[model samples]
Target: MDLNLRKAILSNIESNDQKQLEATIVEAIQNGEEKMLPGLGVLFELIWKQSDEQDKQEMINALEQGVKQETTG
Candidate 1:
């Protein structure tokens, strides 16, 4: 699970030696795995930590609108 990966990532970052993480990410992307989607999902889930309320609301509204439009149209 991500518990190990999160720990490793934290260790790598704290150690300032993220080459393994970078290489692993690049290799996964090159292999055409579904890693990109989950990466984005993790990013999206954590976005509120760095986003303002208004920006967060707008992003959620836009995503909901897009989903609704996709489903209806």
Candidate 2:
């Protein structure tokens, strides 16, 4: 079977507005299901692709801080 997970994920959320998108993300994270990881990753990939260099750096810094906190806490 041919499956394009990223395309599928995008299609699912394409019509969502800002508030709806936030709700989807929050619900997915709160659910804490392993299956949601791929969808979140797809969303992150889209964000990364659309981001400017400064935005990318900020995301990296935030991620680094999150990882450090996770490891040290």
What lDDT, from 0 to 1, does candidate 2 have?
0.95
Give the worst 10-residue stretch by lDDT in candidate 2.
38-47
Q: Which stretches of candidate 2 lie over 4 Å from their true place?
A: none
Q: What overall lDDT goes with each candidate model?
A: 0.64, 0.95
Q: Give the distance in Å from residue 5's predicted Cα in candidate 1 to where it truly belongs.
A: 4.8
The residue ranges of model 1 lying beyond 4 angstroms of the native Cα positions read 1-33
Cα lDDT tens digits for candidate 2, 11-31? 999999999999989989999
Q: How many backbone clashes does candidate 1 have?
A: 0
Q: Spell out the clash pairs found in candidate 1.
A: none
Residue-wise C-alpha lDDT for candidate 1, range 21-53, written one tens digit per residue:
566556656887774655534445546678999
Candidate 1 yields a Cα-based lDDT of: 0.64
